[model samples]
Target: MPIPPVILAGIARMGMTPAALIWGGDTHQELLCGYIAAILMAFSSIASYLPQMKETGKLGFAAVFITAAGNIIISGQQYGIWAYGAYAKEGLFVDITGMLVGIGMMLGTILLAFVTFRAKVFPLWNVLLFVVMLVSFGVPGLESWFALFWGLAYGAMGFTIVSGKYRNKEAAAANSLNLAS
Candidate 1:
């Protein structure tokens, strides 16, 4: 899907450098490199699942593949194009502000996970909430490490559920028997 112009503009605003540190490079190249890295990660996750694909329900596995593939395509294209635009100004405040936002997001994800686990329910709405949480925190002026990590966490949650490994032997045994006869 084509990204909306507003989001595209926002992506363009991100550029290569954060608010601090002058790491010089061709902006387009940096964006492309980052995009490739993310894509590689997504495919690697899929490849890792090759041995256990059938045991995992196809519906859940397909959802994971879609999430990973979609995230890479959207993020890569938007950021790749945006890097060609302006870079942000550098300062202590900028760095600190970004770091704080990243920390907040990381904490928020933890809180959400905690609540879900304690409630003993992994609802689809909860997953959507997590996705919303990631997008809200994934803006520019944040630490890339934190942004990417949360983004990944959001994606991985789907895989965890679909793999059926999250459940005890009761569920797995039932599925195995169902598959057998």
Candidate 2:
């Protein structure tokens, strides 16, 4: 999520458009970072969903799946761009696909967050913060800042999960066992 904007900042510093940046042959690191971020997002989405699942049940499960699918698509797209920059240049399909996936991912994330919020599994403040940061994506002047805040919001939720701040220890333990097997 944050990777693209950071890369865009680098592109701006270099006075290059996004397409030009993709064609520059020096975007390996940026592409790799974006791919890794997508993978991490997928895993974290699953991790956070574990607690919410206890309260939200199958709705939480569905939301996480949607979020995971979006991330997987994003990672695959990044891989394609890294492997075949020429194909990206041939048409608007690549760009359009990226934009659509981004929108879908954003909506999926919002739904998951809302579901979690209703579950009351995580702290209300944290969940609200996460939702607000995500909503900022649509604000024109805050687009760049959203990346940073969204990362912080997501990181806070990750920290909450890791710190065992959720309400149900038994469910979490059982879920961990189920995940392992």
Candidate 3:
């Protein structure tokens, strides 16, 4: 594939935090980038769940997708709060609701990663990067790292799908079994 959809969407996520930093000067940039990130996040979440829905179960699919929605909601809420807060020249941050939402996002991601890893839907690297992404949230200095790692994880998954490595291996194994039988 020329450029995998996951890579593209991952790039969008990678842009989110930087976009937020530069968003201070104008609402347009912030709104534009933030919306793009949210849209991609939504798409990736769904894409991620599709394969799992079969190999793993619908419940895992639903969990991640729902949590991804929660993530989107949190993003939108933060953007608004930060934007307006900036406009007012206040250093204020999240409220109780936002905090709860943030926790929901983190918890959902961690849970999905665990489930997906256990299901072997994706490789362990994908799950590990997701855990890294989850951990990055707690460290302000590591804030940008989360998206970078996420982008890498998604890009890797995309490459794996496009290259047919895993699929072909499975096919080859099944063929061997068939011959033996």
lDDT of 2 by residue, 49-117 (tens): 876666778878888888778878887887787778657545688778778888888777787778877
Give lDDT tens digits, candidate 3, residues 43-143: 66765655555454666766677777875775676476446755533334545666676677767777777777766756677677777777776778775
Where model 3 places Cα greater than 4 Å from the true spot, the runs are 1-5, 17-31, 78-94, 167-181
Global lDDT for candidate 3? Answer: 0.62
Better of 1 and 2 by TM-score: 2
Model 3 quality (TM-score): 0.69
Q: TM-scores of all models?
A: 0.35, 0.70, 0.69
- Which candidate has the highest lDDT of all? 2
- Cα RMSD (Å) between model 3 and the true structure? 6.1
Lowest lDDT 10-residue stretch of candidate 3: 167-176
lDDT score, candidate 3, position 10 = 72
Model 1 TM: 0.35
Candidate 2 displacement at residue 172 in angstroms? 5.0
Model 1, span 1-181: residue lDDT tens: 5542222322332332342124434355446544544454444434323323344445435544554555455454436354545443246754675555445434534444444433333444434545554665556655443334333443444444445444333544454456577
Residue 83 C-alpha lDDT in model 2: 78
Model 2 has an lDDT value of 0.65
CA-lDDT, candidates in order:
0.43, 0.65, 0.62
Candidate 2 structure, TM-score to reference: 0.70
Better of 1 and 3 by TM-score: 3
